[model samples]
Target chain A: MKTKFKKTLYSLSFFLLSICLFTVPTFASGLNWNGHFQTETRVNLDNSALTWQETNLTLQPEVVTNNTRFYGELCYRRSGLLSQNNSLLASTNSNPIELNEIYLDLYAYPWRRMDLRIGKQLIPWGTGYLLNPTSNLNPEDLRDVFDFGRYLGSNALKATTYLGEVTITGVFIPVFTPAALPHQQFQALFAPEMPSLPFTVNEQKIESILPAENLQESAAWGVKLEKHLLGCDFSVSYVDGRYSLPVPKITLTPVGEKVDLLCELIHPRRKIIGFDLAGAYGGLGFWSELAYFFPEEVKVTSDLTAIIGQHMEIVTLKDTPYAKYLIGMDYSADHLYFNGQYLHGFPQEQGKDKLGDYFLGRLEFTLNDGKIKIPFNACLEVRDFNKFQESFAYLFSPEVCFYPEMNTEITLSLRLIDGKSGTNLGKMKDWDEIGLKIKYSF
Target chain B: MMRKTCCILLLIICLTFPLCPVLKSQELTAKEILEKVNSLLNAPQDQKLTLKLVLIDKNGQEETRELIMMQKGKDLRMGKFLSPASQRGIGFLSLPNDVFYVYMPAFKKTQRIATRQKSGKFAGTDFSYQDLGTQQYDEKWSSRLVRAENEQYVLELQAAKGNDTGYSQLILWVSTENFYPLKIEFYDQHNKLCKVLTNHKIQKIAGYLVAQEMEMVDVIKNHKTKMFLEEVEFDTGLSDESFTERYLSR
Candidate 1:
């Protein structure tokens, strides 16, 4: 089985290379190669253990012709330096070789003011900072929880048309891709939860079921109209697609007062209408994003509820509308840069009543001609402001970076958190960590 | 004798007609001289070039990066980084009325930059955003002829009233043969010499004068930035579309 898996990997790599070669007309002059190498180690303060350690390299190759641009990104990672678990599954989890993105851009093809882009690529929308409420086209990449706002590129066909100063963009994604859960260590924290039962004495197991790749069930599409008006950049967009995050579909089996529950997570359909505006005023930059979500109803039923005939079905999610929004501003001068933002909801979080509030701020100081820098970043999450003492959590990270050599950066950082046990971040109270990162680019 | 005087006067009048433009230039006020220099600076309808930038630290260690720059009209400009793997695909668009947007490759989005941010260094280089922008010098600075030395005209420039600039004053030396600036010394708010800019290897390309090499030195920080024009083209007929967000992302 291992040999077969390796063979499949090699074949896929060969196929990518074939496509790259065939698309470039002049290999010697058009092909461009670049990327970076990085190694990072983070230690948990609670247990004094290596929470995360990995070294990775990315190779980016792009070909630019007169009318087209083809680009690709591939990464090789080696992780778990101290762990003894070396199973094939664990190796696959580390994902030694991964293709992150590959796309082609056709400029003014088939029309004078239209551009077409096809293949797997990143579609960035919205004007918010790290917390974007309107830019959900690409699924979340939760593999690295510390890296907020990371997303996986999706296979899509996008067409952009220019009409005067207004731009109209349409996109179609034929296949379905689900959001990636966090690493094994944080899986339990990010997993879907089972609904509260009348009798709590029970057994539980989580299972994930993916939707089939069919047009009616798995496909997604979107359109956006953008223009510059009132001294600001504005856009209105609509996307009809399945939720990247899954909803619970539980099956209950009761034995006397206790119940055994099979918690199954499945993707559901949803539609979003969004608008964003960004502009500058009096030397300050400000932006806002607002989005409303309408999710499909999801009802869960048990296999055997003969004893409780009337209580056999439970609604996991109601067909209701919810809102998400973010506002941000930034200012920079001389040696200091500062940014602040407020977000009403986070990705993977659904429903209007369940949303939390987040406040974020970042300040950086550059000294010695950008050779040495200091940055302080913090986030405050409040589940309920009425019970701020017990329902609020805050995380602060202060870091220093030094560029002692050319094309190199070394950073040392500390993550500190404190909160009650009821909120999301409060549950990870013992996860305070100190990290070191070294990166070199060529 | 009357006939001879008439002939001499006619000969002198004929000579004076051709030198009228030259005499006017010689006696030109500082503002007129600045306008003439600015007209030459903004002569190209559009420009395309590859810029090689080298940053040097106090220890003499150097790092290099490359970018492709395009400019249409006077204030519309765009630049895309082509090297330094960490910064590749990063681009910026500058519009006519101090509007600027920067495309961050990691985030895959274009962000608007605040006007005050222009005072910071660009890409860790010694050149600030104000230095990179194409500005109408006569409108922003009051230029006065200081002296003349070695076929060069020295001028002193002071920031105009109500103009918020990083530098307080600049001393510029221009070649008399051509209106190109040969050297510039920048003074800080306290009237201290903080930086110096030098242009070298002046050449005529596509019937336009260009400085093939330029360097800016920050004395206070002991840093330097050297720029080389590896490839240059003039009058490319670049359209307004090139300065849009679509082109910047590509």
Candidate 2:
């Protein structure tokens, strides 16, 4: 089965390459080819161990003919784990190449003010800088916390219409694609433990039932209306879809003296209503986004007879119509640019106290006629006030980028995670490291 | 003594009455000259142009970019970079009321450029975004004829109050006959000369006089950007819908 999958992947890659080479020159006047090749190396700070060495080559091609536009991006990546202690890559040995984006944009179809886009595309929503609570239409790939550019585009259809100063957009996603989580080996270290039992279980089984694409009811849809009003841009959007986060539907059984726990990962249905506004006053720019989510209740069961009667925990994920809002401002003085955001998650749940309020700030200074830049970014969790949680997870990344030419850049960055053990950022305290990247654009 | 006073008052009234029309006519002439300059610079409704930008540093190192630009009315302009391979598929759109957006192919995203950043260099060129847009001289600045020599009128322009502009004042050397701006000197907020723009070549195309080649030099940085108009079409029948974000991807 693995060999057959690999064969299929290789054949598809070759077919795409052949088509690109043959058709690019034929439509040279309307076709554009641009991409970059990058190499990166990262090492752990405390252990003095090499974490990963990776090389990536990307090819982006775009063709615009009349009212139709086609864009596609193919990326080939090769990564090597230098240390055996790195748990993130322990389950995988082969480096995979992937197609990042492929989409077609059709304009002036049916009407002059309307546009339709079909295929795999990035439908970014919301106004937050780092975290977008309202942007739930597309799943995110968050395996690497430091990599913010990777977003898994969804197979969807989008239509937008312009009416004078107002724009209305509608999106429909027929297939259900879940967010990719971190590697299992790394996740096992942070998995919450169930209540302990007196008797040992013989075997443990875990199952995940993903949302079925074949089911018509599993489809996701979103609508957004944006307009410029009162010297500010305002938008109201709503998404009706399955929650990207999985809920554990656990069943506990007692056979003889041992108890068996079966945990099933399920995606619950949810709805989100969001509003955002962005505007600028003089030299300062400001943006704000607010989202309210209504999620179904999740039920969890454990195999502990002594703790409770039946051992069932009813967890309400986003039970009370939770709201998350973020307000940010950006300003520039001379060569220094600063952006700060204050995020507040209202009415935080009991068990989800760790997912609290945060403040994110970024400062960038450009030098050498904008050729060289130094940026410092920091995120601090501010909700917890207890002594243990007082040392809440705070992540700081300082990076230096030097552009040797217009198409080439070298960057050096360091990620510092500070907090006590068992805190949010403290859990990944071992992953603190420095990285260097060099990229050349073509 | 009363008769002498009356004669003096009548002489004062006679002297000031005739000079008022002459002064009014001079003001009208200055305005007419500006209107002519505006007509030469602004398209009737829409325009299409192919432009080549060459950036030269103090050390003589040069970088060049080629692009095609389309403009609708006085507020909307879109530019697509065509050369340097890496810059291909990059699009810049400027809307009314100081809204600007840039789309990058690699990121596959369109980002808004803040109003404050409009005064910065445009794509690493010497020209700012404000300079690249259609020049609306009368809306932002008040002009007066300073002098006329050798068939050229030198006009001094001061920024109107409450206008957000990068420069405090500008002096333009315009041809008296054609009203085409031949040279301009920009002054900073402190009233210091900061940049100089000179038109090197002008050509008559389709019965319209246009500046074909121009150079802008930053006196402080000693950097220069030279622009060449390779192709131009006025009143190209472009619609307002084409300037909307719906067509930005194309």
RMSD of 2: 6.6
* List of clashing residue pairs for candidate 1: none
- Here, model 1's chain A TM-score works out at 0.92
lDDT of 1 at A299: 84
In terms of docking quality, how is candidate 1 classified?
medium
lDDT of 2 by residue, A201-236 (tens): 756777877765454656899999998888777899
Cand. 2 TM to true fold: 0.87
**Global Cα lDDT for candidate 1:** 0.82
**Chain A TM per candidate, in order of listing:** 0.92, 0.87
Q: Give the DockQ of candidate 2.
A: 0.31
Model 1 lDDT at residue A30: 64
Each candidate's clash count: 0, 0
